[model samples]
Target: MKYLSLLLFLVSITIAGQNDAIAKDYYNKGEFEKALHEYKKLYAQSSSNINYINQIVSTYQQLEQYDEAETFLLNILERINYPAFFVELGYNFQLKNEPEKANTYYNKALASIDVNPNHVFGIARLFQSHSLLEEAITAYNKAKALKPDFNFNLQMAQIYGEQGDLEKMFTSYIEFAVSSPIALNNVKRAINDFITEDSTNDNNIILRKILLKKLQEDPNLLWNKLLSWLFIQQKDFKKAFAQEKAIFNRESESLSGLEELALIALNDGQEDIALEIFTYLINTAQDIDTQLSAHHNILLLRTKLSNKEDFPNIKAQYNKIFEQYGKLPQTLDLQISYAHFLAFYDDKPEAAAQVLDHALDLPLNALQEAKVKLELGDILLLQEKFNKALIYFSQIQRNLKNSTISQEARFKVAKASYYKGDFKWAESQLNILKSSTSQLIANDALELKLLISDNKYEDSTQTALKLYAKADLLAFQNKKEESIIWLDKILKGHKTEPIVAQALYKQGQLFEEQSHYEGAITNYELIITNYRDGILVDDALFHLANIYIKQFNEPEKAKALLEQIIFNHADSIYFVDARKQYRALRGDAIK
Candidate 1:
């Protein structure tokens, strides 16, 4: 009887080892189906062995047999009472998009845990996946209460920021800073964002004061990052300069604070202060990247402060940058910007055209060629050389048919026609362009169509006026080049009558039609100052305000004009629009 029992035990051990070998071999060979079969047979024989059960469950889950995995896990949980197993089951359910089932298993896991931080974190992550942010935050708080850690606090702060709960976000960051002083950089970034977003709010001011007070209590906490932020917010750029100087003097750290100070000064319109910082950065920065950035910003500031007399030096500097970095592909953006500056600011359209011509001739792909051609067209159009502009526009139109460049090219075609005095041809092109896929293009087209069609009926006095009106009407109907001829005839006649105001208004409207907001504003301001009693005065004022708001982003100036229309010309039909605009500018909610 003993010998029989020994033989049976030997057979059982051989079968168990064979099953284990089969399962591992299949798994390692990527034969998941075969591995699952082997694991299941072994799991059935050794039901009490949690390792065997886990293997079977994992194999089943890998095959996406969720029901089978769940059944096996639940059976084990009933016998072993393992919360970690339940958490695994929850994740499997989540993978299957069965949120309710996932939540049930997660809750079950939570019930088994006395205070398991890992289980809490898993639950929080699940809630976060579903965008149940408040629930996630609560669960994260539970995990933190059990054990405050860096990762958990960082996650909590990020979640609050995503929800735009700035106060909570700041507080969480502060908590993280208290726990780990190395996280002070994160705290400074959060505080900066909070103050910027709520610049006018008393709460923001108080929070800043509290942060300053905390820093004062521990002067050692006054790092370069914190000092840069504090001085920037207070607009005490001189102090920011000193702090950056101190950082470099004491620690040999690079003067990164100077970049921040320069940006802040530039934003506050303290151009001289910005220039001072950039000059310092240019001299001090050892990295090539930092030096180039400083030089670029300094040049931009110089351009902003320049008059016509300063253009030659600025142009020379731009040329020097191109000569130094022009071979690098990374400098393409700087090249394009410099080209645009020459075209618009220096009024050297030919120079702009030449730069873009060179860019087009480089080892560029089709997309780059198309972009350069579109910009070349814009420069030529700005210089009032319509026929030369058409060549570039047509090239983009033919080459990049379905691209954004093609759409922009088509719009410019109509604009070039308008500039050449072909109102009829411009209008026809604009009418088709009004249905463009690009919203900006469509809006410009529609606005041009309206200006042409609305003003034609009002031009009836001078014979030249009648002809120009006829040409504009034809342009509206799509006879662009013909319309240009009519406008030319009107200009040749130079009839000094009410019709002249109409002609000037049409000229200004043409500029506006081209998205040349500065030119449009100039022309509109001329009409307002020169032809104040003319019929288009109210229209000019309305459009001038629009240019300030939409193009210049000067809401204060826009608001003033809107209010002026409501106060000075109450009976004008633009009064209602002006009031709504005023309310919008004042940050009032529209019904």
Candidate 2:
């Protein structure tokens, strides 16, 4: 029996050694589940071993078993004076959504004399992960007090930055820079993030002050770069320009700083500053793309600052561009813009026409030709030469078949005819255009068509009551002008007509349309004087008040008219507007 017991003990020792080796191998490979199974068997046999207990806790944590991990850690804390065990317990409670229990354990861990720095860090990470930022910051500070290291400080600074606490972030970054000079990149990134996230101008100013102080203390390249950014954000272009110039002077070239400075000036409306920086880029930047961008921006800024009287200078700039790049396909855009400028600003429509005519003579493509023709038509329209305008518009219409430009040209043709008082031809054109594919063009065409159709019907009033039915149709169509015109003809040709009062009231509306305020007032007075019992008397009085208030701008006259309408025509349809206007003119503050 003794010999058998010795052999079993030797076999058991060999198995335990093999299990330890397997557990270490799995732990090193990060196969935590396999490592846990091996460690669990060893821990079951040797429960008092602190390393075994720790491995079990770690495996439970790896598996996200918060309750198991917390129970194992509490058991270790009860037997051994392991300060870090309390922190692990705190983390487990936090993972279980028990913040109060986590806080209790964290305070206990912090009170220990032999506390591990990792424990403090764990507590900080737990609070930060749970979004308890203020508490996290306090824990992070405690961790830093225990171990003043780069990793802990960086984590604390990042947490403060996430909370948008600029002051704390800046302080931490500055301390980091002073301790580890190689971490200047980190400092720059932190400051940039703080400035970008800050919305208020005052906050920006505060950040600038902090950065400038850092620059004054640390005369490093990173500090200078940060100063340049600060100046750009504050729109102090002169300072930014000087800083970038100093940097490039010391180094060979720094196109990035110059590009950023130019963009900043452009955004702040500092044209001269932008021009200065762009000129520097054109002269010094070796890249063709950078030089081209600089030249383009300089020209754009100059164009924006030039006025109409500076057309000669503007023309000279375009001429220089065409002289240099006339053979290139891209010059066409410049030609188009220059032509438009000559037509509108220089008041040189003939010159504009000649420019476009020359473009047409070139080997132009279809789209280019269509654009030029549209511009030529616009110039003619502005010159008030309707016949000439129609010629260009018609060309675009024929060339750009079934396109939006064709629809636009048809609308312009109708507009030109209407301007020339050719109502019949204009109405025909508008009727066709009313069905255009473009909604805006169709709406305008429909409105003009209605105007012409109603006007002709109203003008065909030979007899007094002959077109009464037509006038009613006009009213229904909201053709206020034609309805009033036919009504006026009736009042003059058939004064004894039964609809005389209605006609007189409509005549008041026509006078109002023509902005003849006194004429409208006189017609309304006729309605009140001659047809007091007429149903339109109340309407006439109400419209008279509107004419006085709106057309004539006579507040007192409007006030009296409204009061009269309210007193004599209380049941009129215009009672609402009249009462509102009356109260407003009386200074009653009507909304």
Candidate 3:
């Protein structure tokens, strides 16, 4: 008997749900008369069902049966005393051009809110649905007054923003963030819609004043963190560093945030501030790993930012660090970086090879030895010792089979082969790396493979391709002027060849790397103009956009280029980055 009852109950629910779905389908198909007929039947079966009643009323309104909608709303209001029904009746009458009756019902809805604080939400939602911003604000304020812990600040902030009350919007967002800590990121996102990197902008000044005032009134750590975030948004790393320090000291947390800030500063070209942050961490960080990382980054920053004349001093500092830390696994990255600095910048590949060879003698794990070998192989390849480089790279591949480092070693081998004019071997290695676990390596392998295969058949002797590869190797070796010279040879001699686009793109990259924006722009624009459908078109567009935005401060031109990538090259590897940059340049809020 119980099983029969359960089956019957489910059958009844199924019938009712099917009836509801049929009515919805009718409404969606614009067969409102049929929908009304179905909903009226359902309402008769369940007279107390509010959903059925609301759907019937909405269907009436959809069919422009405003009088019927008003009648049903009035009847429901008499039965339930729901404040939202009054607003619905008012809207129905307004739709029927009965302004006086609409006003009366609207006033009743507002008056009904005072009878029950919880009804304020329904009244506010009704007002918001009708775009009555001021009325909705009053209703929400009433509810908050009735319930002190009520959190409508985020909603109010959105409304205030829509109403152009930016100060109030800012205040409301901050209040919401204070009440709900997890919503801090949301608040920052909302602020990003209006804020920009210009420190002298009005919005920035207003935000700064508000933050300063809050800090003076209440010394909360959230304010400090937010101020730090604001400074970062403005690209004011020095001020951001000060605020992050305040947050760290107040909270006594780990140095993770400070470390991240330093990296951000470094990436943003704030070398001095990043150096200061790293110096502070090296002296104050409790963990040895953090100290070592800071030391490594400091050297990296010096190598990137310091003048060539300071190479000897930087070398002496590296020696001092190696002497203090000794040759251990913990300091291996710094040691490797020092080797790279010596080889690439100081033109001391022999010395760089010697350092790595000594580091390789330490008691190291497989990965560590692989890393050292990779660097050694690179230096060897740089010195044109392709056979020696191949040996080291092959050792890593044998030791760490099926690993990311193995794939990296294979890529180096292919690169070395390509540089040695052994196209057949290089093409074989590159084909295997097309499915590499690392997307970057896979893309690189595919690109190099395409370059070799595409240009190999263009010329019988492959002189242009060989020249381009030598130029690429020179660029890799930091011999920029020499690389340009080699590239110029191809550009002048092989004007009609497909290699011209490749050479132009490479020259553009070298110029961009050297901060020669106009030169880079000229080459990139040539690729865009002359080789619009070529493989490097998107690359040229993206680099040109980056140069315009970051160096030339011409966001409009940058936006145009990014748009080209976004619309013209959806399948391009730069598609995602281009879209993000396009939105950011257009001042969209970034989360």
Candidate 4:
């Protein structure tokens, strides 16, 4: 008997829901008479359902029966204490051109809020729905005045924003964020629409002024953090770093925020501020990990900016760090970084491999040991010991099956095979890795696979491909100059070949590595002009645009080039970055 009753309740609910959908469908299709008939039946079955009441009134109005809507609202208002019904009645009378009656009903809705302040929400939403902005604002203000505990700042902020009053909007949003810190990120997302990449934009200046005034008055860390975020959005890394510093001093808390700020500045090419932040971390960080990370990045930045003339000095800096820290287990990552510097920067792969060999002797976990072996394999590959590198990579793959690091090792195995001209095994490995869990590894595998497959048919002997692989291997060995020369040979010998575009891109990268900006631009421009339909066209365009921005100080040209990728090559891997840079260059207000 209980089961039968439950089943009957469910069946009735399904029938009612279907009836509701049918009424809504009829109303949407402009069959208002039919909609009104169905709504009346539903309202008769459930007289307490406010939704059915509202729909019946709306269907009456839709069918030009405003008097009927007024009658129904009046009859229902006594049974339901819905202040919003007064607004709806006012709307119905106004639709019938009874202005004085409409005003009376609107005033009645506003007055109902005083009797119960919670009625303000429904009344204000109804007023706003009818485009009655002033009435809505007045209702919210009246409720707030009557009840001191009411917080309508978020609603007020949206209204003020819609009204083009940014000052009030920003102030209300700030107040809302302060009152409910949990919604702080949501508030930031809301306000970010008005902010742009331009630091000197008037909206940005206004937001800054507001944030700064709050900072002066309250001395709250949230204000400073918001100020920092605002500065970051404006690309004002120096000011952002200062705010981060103030927050750090006040909280004396974790260095994670400061670390993130440093990386942000670094990524945006604010190298000096990043270096300062890193130096500060290295000096103030209490933990060994933070200090090691700071030291690691500082050395990396210095090496990247250094020429061969500065190589020995960078090595001495590394040695000084080791002398101070004594190559302990905590310093294992630093050791691996140092090995990479030695191999890739200092022309000492053999010495780099020896460092990792010593590191392998240390007692480490599987992940730590795998990390060391991965770098070791890369170094061995740089030294042309492809089989030896594969030994390490294969071990990592076997031990950590299906892990991200294992997939990375698998990718490396394929790459090493490609560099050694073992195309068949490399192709097999790449085909498997095309669906890797790591997108970066999968992308790399697919590109290498395409490069091998595209050129394999053009030459029966694979002579040109072998030379290209040799050039690639040379570049991996940090022999950028030799790599460029070999790529030139491929360009000369295989001028009509499909691999020419790849050769040009590789040579352009080598040129950029050597700071030969014009040579890089020339090669990249060639690819853009001749290979507009090719896979590397987006890459060429992006790289060329970057050179224009970073090297030539010609953002207009960069903007134009990036626009091509935005409109033409939307599927390209560089499309997102191109759109972002393009928008920044164009000073787009949209975030």
Best by lDDT: 4
Over 1-591, each residue of candidate 1 has an lDDT whose tens digit, in order, gives: 999999999999999998899899998888889998888788778887766776787788778899888877777778975566766687778878998987787677555434567767555665666566776776666666666652576678778877876656666676677777877876776665445322345445555555566656765434444555666665678767877776676666666667877888898777888888888887888786777788888887787677789989998888797787663445555566677778777767787778887786688777777777777777776666779889988888888886767878888888777656566787888898888888888887886676666554554432553466466554543334455556656656765544555655665666665556776677678778888876678888898898897678999988987887888788787998787667657754211
Provide the overall lDDT of each model, using Cα atoms, as 2-decimal numbers: 0.71, 0.71, 0.89, 0.90
The TM-score between candidate 2 and the true structure equals 0.42
Question: Which residue ranges in model 3 land beyond 4 Å of their true spot?
Answer: 1-63, 72-82, 107-116, 120-123, 306-308, 422-437, 453-456, 545-591
Worst 10 residues of 2 by lDDT: 193-202
For model 4, residues 329-431, the per-residue Cα lDDT tens digits are 8889889989999999888888998999898888889999999999999988987888999999999999999999999999899889888888999999999
All candidates: TM-score: 0.46, 0.42, 0.84, 0.90
Best by TM-score: 4
Error of 3 at 249 (Å): 2.5
**Best to worst by lDDT, what's the order?**
4, 3, 2, 1
Instruction: Report how far off residue 172 is in candidate 1 (Å).
Output: 5.7
Predict model 4's lDDT versus the native. Answer: 0.90
Q: Return model 4's CA RMSD, one decimal.
A: 3.1
Question: Which pairs in model 2 have colliding backbones?
Answer: none
Relative to the true structure, candidate 4 reaches a TM of 0.90
